[model samples]
Target: MKWSEICIHTTEEAIEPVTNILYEAGAGGVVIEDSQDLQQTFLSDEGSEYSLDPADYPIDGVNVKAYLPVNSFLGETVEEIKQSVNSLLLYDIDLGDGRLTFSEHNEEEWATAWKKYYKPVSVGEHFYIVPTWENFDPEDPNRKVIELDPGMAFGTGTHPTTVLCIEALETHMSKKAEVLDVGTGTGVLAIAAAKLGARKVHAVDLDQVAVQSAKINVKLNKVQDVVTVSRNNLSDNVKGQYAIVVANLLAELVIRLAEGGVADLLQKDGLLIASGIIRPKKEQVKEALIKSGLHVIEEMDSGDWIALVAEKAE
Candidate 1:
């Protein structure tokens, strides 16, 4: 069988959302080729022949490639993906090269080739993100394992956005508290909150697929008793004030939530950890938070991404 390899040349800031678009479009598998990977040191087995070739990377941005079966609906599917990607510009998201190209391959050529690129990584001080198929026994007692079968949904805490959020949680969570994880893709942050001794965690996502995926991962982490996964739009009609509210969403969504009274959902002196923001867009998000009655107390940066921690202001 033939497969269509759809490639999107986009900014690093757009990777998470773009990947979600592809997965939502029924991608068989996704491969992210970032130019910065050439500079970062990675873990590998002593006898492994794995090495990144310069030729396979884009010199400036990122290449998000997804494999799909060649079929009658291929043309429409590609069009829809293009439209969805183009719509990001409406919210001030940079499209970078904004170029897309397609190539054909045999089913066997890419069916499992991308799996080799995914390996266990330590995302934060306390959490180790392990792919479900891999075996991991942490040597550090403080290091807890989160086994993920990420399938189509993202946020296994490997991405810088999720990593920043997890790190922020680790630093701010000094005592048990009730947590609200907005845009809880794969339930990574909610699971992190649970691991950090959150008395209760409400993990909500707008996407049903993400909700289901989060539910599975939450159970896989055995935090089911502490975390509840549900389907809900971003901060809409979310009841009860939380001790901590973490929103890992786009800058526009963050602003919208902030304006929509996300601060009102926080208890007095509660923290709002906002992430999934590009460095360029941090100011606008911070302004939105402050305007919504929250004071930005801390900011974390990783590559071109930024995460902001804010507290309820008087």
Candidate 2:
């Protein structure tokens, strides 16, 4: 079988969001060729055999490549992916040159190539993010493991934004609490909530692919009984008040959701965990939450990303 390899030239700051765009467009795996990777110290020979051609990498930015099957809808899919990546600008994310290119390759060439980049990662204190292909045994018996294969969904539970959300959840999640995870890509936050003893979790994503992916991950984590994955835009279709509402979305989207009344979806004094926000937009998102009748209680930062924890006004 033939595959279309889509390569996006973007900055490191845009990597997570751009890769997420490809994932949402049904790219099964992604390979990142960052110029910085060449300078990093190697701990093992795992990636030594993989040829790193300087010609294939950008001198000033990173190149993210994803494989999509060559099919009738390939053109439309690629266009949609480009549009989604471009939309990152609304969140003030830098895309560098924003050059996108593609080539045709054999399916066998990329089938296992992306796996080298994924490894077991510890998210919060008690949660470990383990890829499906990795065999990991936690040294701490009290640690909970979330086994995941991202497939075409976004959240890998490794990005700093996701790590902030998971850590926030760990601190605010109450036993038997009813949680709502908006934009629940791969259902990572929802699964975490369930594992943390939430009585019920409503995981919703606007992307159908994400909804399906979340369902699979929820079941894989053995939390299907506690988590319900569905397709919904923001909190549009979500009913009832939640003890906690978590959204790992762009700063712009978070503001829109906040203005559209995210506080209405939360119970009084309930917590809201908003992530996927860049440092520059941190105050903007906080103001939006405050205007929506929520008060910022805590702020967490990792690199250039920030996550805000808020509580509904009494």
Candidate 3:
């Protein structure tokens, strides 16, 4: 069967919402090519098999790709997808270099084209990301293995913001701590929390695509019992205070959550890890968090992005 290969060249920040848009329009799987990967080193051993081909990535931005079977509704589906993704600007999302394109491909090529860009790699200190298709083991037996079908999820553990969040979770999150993972893309953070010993995890995202992807990932990692995935905007309407809350969102949204009293969702002296803030906006996010009652404990950076680890007052 022939398929329409839809590709969107957009910013990294828009990945989740855009991928969600495609999923809502009947896309089965999505492939993300982050330009940042060109400069990233996934594992310490440079000789490892993991390498990204420049041809697969956009020159200046991220590319989100998906395949849909050609059908009578193909034109209408494409239009709908375009309109829905364009609508994200209403939410103040930066869709930088947002260019859309389509091409035709056979089922065989569509099935295997994305495999070259994905491979098992370690994230942070404890978590190792392995695609379900690869049969591989980490050199460290103690490294927590997270098996994910990346073709069906949001993140591949290559983003710096995500790594910074994972590292912070490893350092500050306590055993059996109930975790609230705000903006849980691909449910990686939620699963990380579970691996690090969080007893109960609530993974929330505003995008239905992420919610569904995260749910699948949570189960794939066998942390279904510990992490509950839901669709919600930040902390609005979320019940139950948590000992640890992690929000890996843009600076503005993080500030909005801070102003919205996201810290109130935390128990006394509990930690809040806020990331996805570019370096220039670091102070802006920090100020907002402090205004909303979180004390800045420490800050970590992964390239231009930053993660703020704060605590609610006891």
Worst 10 contiguous positions by lDDT, candidate 3: 41-50
lDDT digits (tens) for residues 266-290 of candidate 2: 9988999999887888999999999
Comparison by lDDT, 1 against 2, better one = 1
Candidate order by TM-score, decreasing, is 1, 3, 2
Candidate ranking under lDDT, highest first, comes to 1, 3, 2
Give residue 236's error in model 1 in angstroms. Answer: 0.4
User: Which portions of model 1 show Cα errors greater than 4 Å?
Assistant: 37-57
Q: RMSD for each model, in Å, please?
A: 2.4, 4.4, 2.9
- Candidate 1 least-lDDT 10 residues: 40-49
Best candidate per lDDT, number? 1
Tens-place lDDT digits, model 3, residues 18-135:
9878988888567888888887654423325545668878888789998888999999999999899889999767888789999989888878878767777788788788777777
Q: Each prediction's TM-score against the native?
A: 0.92, 0.84, 0.86
What's model 3's lDDT at 220? 88
